[model samples]
Target chain A: MIRKHGIKLTSVAILIAVLVAWEVLPTALDVPRFIIPTLSDSLAELQRMWANEGLLGHILSTALYTVLGFLIGSLLGAVMGYLLGMSKFWEKVLSPYILALQIAPKVAFAPLFIMWFGYNSMPKLLVTVLIVFFPVLVNVLQAMRTVDRDLVNLARAYNLTRLGIFWKVEMPSTVPNLMAGLRIASTLAVIGVTVGELVGGNTGLGYLISYGGGQANAAMVFNAIILLTVIGFLLYVVLERIEERVLHYLPKAHQ
Target chain B: MALEFRNVSKSFATQGDGELLAVDDVSFRVEEGEFVSVVGPSGCGKSTILSMTAGLYQPTSGEVLVSNVPVTGPNSHVGFMLQKDLLLPWRNIIANIEFGLEARGVPKADRRARAMKELDHCQLSGFENHFPYQLSGGMRQRAALARTLSIDPEIILLDEPFSALDAQTKLLLQNSFAKTIKDAGKTTLLITHDLSEAVLMSDRILVLSERPGQVIAEIKVDLPHRDQPIRRRVLPEVGEYAAQLFKHLKLEEKAA
Candidate 1:
């Protein structure tokens, strides 16, 4: 119980310690302001960027694209995973295509996507979907395929139809696997969005990181990376909590 | 007819042995409401015989008849409970029992009532809402039996049903085995490796040779089917009969 909230405190402490070190060490070393900005210098830069420019809006803009891309990618992956799993013939035929897509470098398609959808949210969204779909699809399909054979045979001896077996047997057994897949997919979805933004996105965290690098504002690039990483962490933790609550009645191992 | 195996032969291709014969030219008749058992060594293909009877696997050279009609595939009127209870964890007891009805496309309302009736019959009325994981192993087997009986199958094929249980539990279960079949007016064919279980529960026991399984003998059990297993075990003649069956099975085991 004590450890439940310990993670949050530990994260805050680590951030404070890094900032304190960043603040004190630069001044002590007499490093130039541009070369190694102090924590105070970074904060002042943030404040000026906020006041003189639409920097905060850009951050929010990037977040929106990330969230949208992730949602679309994750939902489609889950649906297709279940559909393919439901049919053996379809699984045999379509699973190879899905596997090939998963293994084929997602970035290689980025240039092709730019040509097809152009440098906008569409290309970024497509890239995000490509990255996010594989984890959920693979996990969900495996979960469905690997139901206890005895249970299925039992159902059959009772003369259960395919639909009946699937609803009462296959789906429930796969839920733990589904949750695991979702957890992984949730994190990957963010990566997908940012990658899409990096290659062709105009209004996401990916674009900001690239824009910062192009302008030689290392501080802004660091800030974008920090914010994105925090968002990714929060998304993962939140989804995991939801999975736990939803699967509370499920049998758990003595961890 | 309670159960009939008409010159049944089951053969499967082996890696090096080429078309390994499991049960060859086997014919047996079980009377209506009779409790019959087939006892053999581990590789005697007792399960294959049971599976053929249940219509899970087909006999290569013959037919299995329950009440005269040949069984080609799974029949709704035939209940099968394997060694494992095979209960779906997601479903509660009532729903698990109703799985048969769900497969048959029985109406939801009727299945609910039928499930309740079965639960009451199995003395698991209060546990209808409990999951398989929550129930005791004995209770789970009881529920599994209820699930089988719910479909009102005339012939129940039990393949190594008590093999997974502990010795005390197996003993307890073996005691109830005969009474339950008699009380339900259901003909039962139990396949087991335990000689005592076959003698204790069966009205007639089929003894088979190992590997390329063949019916060596059919021994009649003269012990009366009683309500309690402990009392059944204490019967003076029961032990002698079990010992006789044990010697036959053991001799075959040594030869194999």
Candidate 2:
């Protein structure tokens, strides 16, 4: 118990030290405020933005788009993965096009989406969906391919229908991989939304950072970046909790 | 006959090797409630025979019949078990046992009661809520057996079901399984490399040659207390039966 407490204390200490350095180092080294703002300056800018720049609206917009994109992308990916897994002919026929799409950097599509959908939320949502889709699809498809053949044979021997086999055996077997893919996509969802917002968004935390940069206010930019990180971190934590609950039956590795 | 393989031969199409024969013209009959084991050297297609009996594999030529009907596809009348427990790790023990029943569309309450009874029969009563990974290897195999028995299949096809266990666990499981199967009067066909296991539990043993397996020898185990495998293990006749099977397999291996 003490060792556990010790580990927690060490983490806290590291966080405190980083905060102290952020506050103290800039002025101690006589660095200009525009180059590397002190922690106080960033915090003041955060308060000012809260009062004047509708900061809550930006945070909520980014969070909303991140969640919406994640849900839609995950659903699309899972459906496509199962469809492809079930039909080898279609999987073979479509693999080349899918591969080409996957190979191209997802962030590079942000500009194209913006061009097609204009500067509205559509581009950001589309970009987030694109970024989140591939990881889930790849992981689920790989999982479907490697499901235990013996188990499937056993199910067949019981005269389970093809749908029954898929529902009972194949689907449950791919869950671990599916959860893994979702976790990866959760983080990527944030990157996707940020890229879209950076390219053309007029609202959201990404827009705030871009706007702050244009105004040469490093402190405002720093505050927006910190808020964005918090959003991503919260999403990751939520996914991890869900994973723990869903995979409770799986044995944990020995510490 | 509960199970019959009439001149069944199985071959697979290899990528570059054309046709690869596994089992060649094997004929056998398993009477109702009889415990038969097919013992062979490695790669002798012992598993292929079980798969065909389960209707998972079609014979390249001839036929495998269960309860007088030729097996054309996966058969509802057959229960198959393999070396791996193959329990759904995400499911608790009772849920795993209920899998086959669920597939057959048994009512929810009926499935639970039958699965619970099998769990008790297999001596896994307290572990019903525990997942497969939480159980010991012996207990997991017991759950697997419960899963198979829950389906109430006419013929149980076992492909090296106990081969993965340690010697002690294997013997214990063999004794438990023999008693359970005998009490249920289920027709069981076991595939194994262990001659002693074949001799201990089976009423009759079929010895197959190496790859392109044929039923080279058939031994009738005329021993008392066949249901009690542990008791039968110490009998002088058991050793003799094992030795005979070993000789058949060794000779086949040498020829290969």
Candidate 3:
């Protein structure tokens, strides 16, 4: 029991140590608050925003855009991956173009998306979708292609219809791969949304960071960054739980 | 004939290789309600025969027939159990057993009933809700057998079904499998590398040569009261059959 709790205990201890150092070091060293705010000051700033600055609204907006982008991107990626994975002809025909799109830096598209969709949430959503798309596509394709041939042959031997084979064999076999991709995509979705805010978003945690940097309010920037990190961590944990539940039957090696 | 492979030949195209013949003019007939085991060296096209019989592979030449009908596609009357149990990991044992029945459009309740019956028959009554991973190797193989049997296929193809089990489990499962297949009156074509397995379970054993496999010998197993395979293994004739198959396989191995 102690060993099982060891990691969490150590993490908490380290976190407290860091917070203490963050709070004490700046004032002890006579460092300016604007340059490096104390932990207390950042927390206070977070509270103030929560109470009066509509920070909750900003968090909700970012979450919405992130989830929407993640869902759309994952859906499109999975569909495209299924097509490419199942058909060698399509893979051969379209792989080069897909490669080019994947390799191109995503940040470069933010400005272009802004130009097309304007300064509204549309540009941010599009940016997030584009950023989250590739990992899901690549993972899904790899998973589908490498599905156990024996299982597929078993289905064929049973004289399952083409659709039946796909539903009963192909889909279930790809769940692990899809779950892995979705986990990755969820994290990337957060980053994608942040990047969008950094580039052109008007009211999100990303915008707060950008605004705080301009005003040299280190406390505000730290607060926004902390919240963003927490959001990403929570998203990852939830996705992992879903993965665990869905793939409960997977052997230990797979888990 | 419940199943017949008439001068069947199969070749696969390999990377940068012109062609690799796997089965060369192999011919065999499996009578209704008979259990025939094909023993050979690895890569001797033992599985190729089963696949062709299942209609998953079309022969380069000749034909595979089931109940006097040419197998143009996957034969509905055939149930193939692979070396691996190949149970759907996401499904429980009962669900896996019902996979073929579901594909055949059996009603949900009917397939469930059939699956439960097979599970009980396989001595896995309580494991119906358990996943394949939760079961032991022997149990998993029995579950695979139950799944195949649940479909009520006239022809059953077993590819090294008990090869992955422990020696004790193999013997036990083999006995039970022999009894089950006999009771079902299904024509079973088993492919394996184990000579003893062939001698113990088969009414007839077909020994095949190495790659580009062809029948080297066919020996009729005439053990008394063959239904009790584990008991017959103590008899002298089973050893003789095993030795005969070993000799034929060794000859092919040396020739290769």
Q: Of the candidates shown, which would achieve the greatest DockQ relative to the real structure?
A: 2
Instruction: Summarize candidate 2's per-residue lDDT along A22-94 as a digit string, tens digits.
Output: 9999999999999899999999989999999999999999999999999999989988998898888989999
lDDT of 3 by residue, B1-256 (tens): 7988899999999999689999999988999998999988889899889888888889999999999899988867999887798888899999999988877788899999999999998999988889888999989889999999998999999999888888899889889988888888889999988888888888899988889899989999987655667898898777778778768777556878
Per-residue C-alpha lDDT of model 1 across residues B40-159, encoded as one tens digit per residue = 888888888877877777999988998999988877768888888988776789988988877777899999999898788777879988888778788888888888888989888898
Clashes of each: 2, 0, 0
Candidate 1 positional error at A135, Å:
2.0
* Candidate whose TM-score is highest: 2
How far is A37's C-alpha from truth in model 2 (Å)? 0.4
Evaluate model 2 with DockQ and give the value.
0.87
Fnat for model 2 comes to 0.95
Clashing pairs in 1: A62-A204, B77-B153
By DockQ thresholds, what CAPRI class is model 3?
Answer: high
Q: Which 10 consecutive positions of candidate 3 chain B have the poorest summed lDDT?
A: B246-255
Give one digit per residue, the lDDT tens place, for model 3 in A10-119.
Answer: 99999999999999999999999999999989989989989987999989888888889999999999988987888989998998999999999876898898888888
Ranking by DockQ: 2, 3, 1
**Every candidate's TM-score, chain A alone:** 0.86, 0.97, 0.95
Question: Over the stretch A1-255, how does candidate 1's per-residue lDDT look in tens digits?
Answer: 678689889999999999899989988998876677777776776776678656777667656766676677778887888899988899999877887889998867777888998877777778777787788888989998888887877777777677877877888888888888878877876777777778876676677778877987766676677778877887788888998876765667764
TM-score winner between candidates 2 and 3: 2
